[model samples]
Target: MRVLIAGAHGQVGHELLRFAPDGCEVVALGSAELDITNAQQVAKVVERLRPQLIINAAAYTAVDKAESEPERAWAVNRDGIAHLAQTAERLGIPIFHISTDYVFAGDASEPYRETDPTGPTGVYGASKLGGELELVANCSEHIILRTSWVFGAHGNNFVKTMLRLGREREELGVVADQRGCPTSAASIARALWALAVQYREHGSLQWGLYHFSGTPACTWHEFALEIFRQAHALSLLERVPLVRAICTADYPTPATRPAWSVLDCAKLRETLGIAQADWREELAQVLRELA
Candidate 1:
């Protein structure tokens, strides 16, 4: 299978490049090389590569900044995806995409299924939802994997932030009210490649929306505690900082974060036999790499 990966320098995209399985021909590009927001470039590139499939890791992911820059967010998140989907539709090829858990309103009491009603509270979520709609409208063969709390050895994520703070401060406060699963970039790459391999063997997929996230939900405070614990054990940090549990109201941002970002990934597991990754184990691997 010949695959083209967008957002090649991003957290997930980088892992997709590193963990690409054998027997697959991969061409990955960063935003500078193939700006999806530019329709002409997208058309030209797809024409040149003629990839069997396109896995789009590109996204405008500045959650708080998106509140002040809705137009920019929509341009990249919605319009950019529309270009990719349309090009894929024209070529009669499949397109796989990454989406966020923020598409749901923060009010859900239980884990959200793929069919759950979406009500985005922030500009970033609204823009991503727009992209999802555009992809569905444009492409017949597509899979949208809505994930949450993605972190990796590369890129700026909550894990890196907590590590930096752990080194700088003796104590810190984290929002305990918010809950979500912390998925690693490598795990997501593995899932996507599994789907790619299945499609290559079968020539088609049971393609649609599916939720893929890490196992066992926890609060940000709890996530931070684990990061410090692991980092200290790995000698990545000299000492573990005290993480104080606090309400969301204590820390304000321009955009409202979804309180419930846990996704029920049973559908993917049952259909594709891809199990939810245990984030604790993934975190250890990441910490070891960082150390």
Candidate 2:
């Protein structure tokens, strides 16, 4: 089976390349190599590759910056996806797209389900939701996997940011009111590889929207403290900084973040028979890699 991976340089995309299943031919393309936003370019590349499956990891992920660049955000998130869905539908190939948890309003007391109503709070979230809708409407065979708070050894993410601050500062402030699961890119890649293998072997997969994130949701403050703890244990930090918990108002940004965007993965487990990984264990592995 031949698989095409867009956004190959991203955190999850890079991991996908590294963890690609055996006996499968993988063609990974970064934005520079094949920009999804360019419809002609996308069509030409997909036509040339003729991959059996396409995994779209490309996205405009600047949450705060999306407020000032909605057009760019929509172009990459929504328009790019529309192009892929149409092309894949034309070629009779299936697509696996990654989405985010920001599609929710974040006011729910319990975890958000796949059937929950979407009310994106910021331009970034709204654009991603648009992409999901476009993908569903344009393609018949597709898997839209929504996740949250993704981090990894590679890429600019919360974990890397916290590690950098911990090394440079004695004190750091993180939002305590907001809570969500921290998923590892490596885990996501592994899950995608498993799904791809299943599809290749069985010739079909259960399609539709699904949620898959790390187990044990936590606040940014708690995540920061854990990072410091692990970094200290690894001797990667000369001195672990004091992580101060603060409300959303204490640290303002251009985008309004979800106060509680935890997603329930029961559907994923029940339908796909996939289990959620312990985030702490994944964090330890990432720390080891960084060290």
Q: In candidate 1, what are the lDDT values of residues 1-291, reduced to their tens digit?
A: 899999989999999998999999999999999999999999999999999999999999999999999999999999999999999999998999999999999799899999899999999999999999999999999999999999999999999999999999999999999999999999999999999999999999999999999988999999999999999988999999889999999999999999988899999999988899999999999988887
In Å, residue 56's CA in model 2 sits off its true spot by: 0.4
Off by over 4 Å in 2: none
lDDT, residue 68, candidate 2 = 97
Tens digits of per-residue lDDT, candidate 2, 145-180, equal 999999999999999999999988999789999999
For each candidate, give its TM-score against the true structure.
Answer: 0.99, 0.99
Write down the RMSD of candidate 1 (Cα, Å). 0.6
lDDT of 2: 0.95
Tell me the lDDT of model 2 at 245. 91
Q: Residue 276 error for model 1, in Å?
A: 0.4
Residue 172, candidate 2: how far off, in angstroms? 1.4
After superposition, which runs of candidate 1 have C-alpha atoms over 4 Å from their true positions?
none
* Steric clash pairs (candidate 1): none
